[model samples]
Target: MIIELKSLDEIDPCEFAYYANDPNINTYLRNSFPAPYTLDHALSFITHSLQHHALDFAIVVDGKCVGCVGVTFQKDIFLKNAEIGYWLNSQYWGKGIMSQVIKMLCSYLFSNYTIHKICADVFAENKASCIVLEKNGFIQEGYRREHIYKDGCYHDLILYALWRNSDEY
Candidate 1:
C-alpha cells in the first residue's frame, strides 16, 4: 500500500471525480465541496489546484488518485497560519493512509514555507478525522458550539493545531 502525495496534474478529472463523488466523504468537508460532484467541478478544482500546487495535493494510493489534502494560508496579519483539510475515498479509509498524508503535508509546509502553525477545523462528530489529526501531533485548541451550518443543521466544530516547533512532530 504505497501512499503518495502528488500534484493534481497527475490525475484526470474523471478519476478525481469518480472517487470524490461520495456523499459520505463530503459530509465532513466544507460547503465548497459540492455534492453530486461532477466532472466540471473536478475540472474546475484541478484548474484551481494547478495554480496552487504548493498548497494542495492529490493523495495517491498504489497509483490511484483517491483523495486530497491541502492547506489554506491566511493573509495579512495571520500570514504564518494555515488551515489544513483533507478527505479520502471511503474504500481507502481506516488503513492509516490519512495519518501518513497529514505528516507528509506538515513536513512539506514547515520545510518549504514560512508557516508557523497548521490547524484543522473538524466537525465534532467526525471522530476519525480528529484521530488522524491527533496522530499527526495536532492538539485540540478550541471547540466552537454550532459553528458549522451544514445540511440545514448546525454542527459543532473542533479546532486542532500543531506548531512548527512542536516536538511531537
Candidate 2:
C-alpha cells in the first residue's frame, strides 16, 4: 500500500472523525484525544495545527487519511527536544505503517529543526507502540510507575528517546 504524509489541511474532517471515533484507538493516547471523536473535534484540531504551522501531518494510506503523527516542541532549557506522538486506524495496525510513519516524521523533524532529541511517552501496556519506537531506534530511557491516569485508573509510563546521531535516523 502507498503511504504518505500530508498536511492536515488536505484531509476531510469527516473522514478523520470517522476513523478516530473508535474507542480502541484512544486506549494508549492522551485523554485529549476524545472518545467518540466528532467532526467538530477534528476541525478544531486541524485549525490549531494550521494556525501553529505545527509539524503534524496526516498519515495517508492509499490516498486516504488514516491517522496522524506529530511532535510537541519543548521550550526553556529543553528547547532542543521534541516529544513525538502518533496513532493509526486499527485496520492499519501490524502492517508496519506506524513504524514507517514514525521514521518519516523523525527524519523530517531532524532535518528541518534544530532539535537534537525526539522522545515518546507510552503507556507501559502498549507493547505495540514500544516496539514501533524501538524499530525506529528509540531507546527506553525511563519507566515511571503509575504515572498515567487514564479511564479512571493509573498506568505505568515508558519514556523512550532517540538522538539525532542515531545511525538509523
Candidate 3:
C-alpha cells in the first residue's frame, strides 16, 4: 500500500467521521478524540488545525484518509522538544504503513525545525505501537505506571524518544 500525507481538506468530512468513529482506533489515543465521532468533530478538528497552524497531516492510503499524524512543538523550557502523535484506522493495522509514516514525519520534523528530540507516549497494553516506535529507533525513556485514566480505568503509559542529533538513531 502506497501511503501519502496531505492536509485534512483533501478528506471528505463524512468519510473522516466514519473512520474516526471507530472505537478500536480510538482505544489507544487520547480521550479528547471522542468515539462516536461526528462530522462536527471532524469540522472542529479541521478548524482547530487551520486556526492554530498545527503540524498535522492526514494519512491517505488507497485514496482514503486512514489516519492522522502530527507533532506539537513545546513551549518555554520545553521549546526544543517536539511531541508526536498518531492513530491509524483499524483496518490498516498490520500493513506496516504507520511505521513508514512515523519515519517520514520524523525526518521532516528534524529537518524543518530546531529540535532536540521527538517523543511519543504509548499505552502499555499497546505493544504494537511500542514495537513501531522501537523499529523507528525511538528508545524507551520511562514508564509511567497507571498514568492514564481512560475508558473508566487507569493505564500505564510508556515514554519513547528519538534524538535529532543522535548517531545511533
Best by TM-score: 2
Highest-scoring model, lDDT: 2
How much is the lDDT of residue 63 in candidate 3? 89
lDDT of each: 0.90, 0.91, 0.89
Residue ranges of candidate 2 with Cα displaced over 4 Å? none
lDDT of 1 by residue, 76-116 (tens): 99999999889998998899999999988899889888889
Q: What would the per-residue lDDT of candidate 2 be over residues 69-153, giving only the tens digit for each residue?
A: 8889999999999998898989889999999998888888998999999999999999999999999999999999999998899
Better model by lDDT: candidate 2 vs candidate 3: 2
Question: Candidate 3 on 6-90: residue-level lDDT in tens?
Answer: 9877788777777788878878888788888888999999889978999999998988987889889999999999999998889
Could you tell me the C-alpha RMSD of candidate 1 in Å? 1.2
Q: What is the lDDT of residue 47 in candidate 1?
A: 91
Winner on TM-score (2 vs 3): 2
Q: Can you tell me which runs of candidate 1 are displaced by over 4 Å?
A: 52-54
Instruction: Return the TM-score for candidate 2, rounded to 2 decimals.
Output: 0.97
Clashes of each: 0, 0, 0
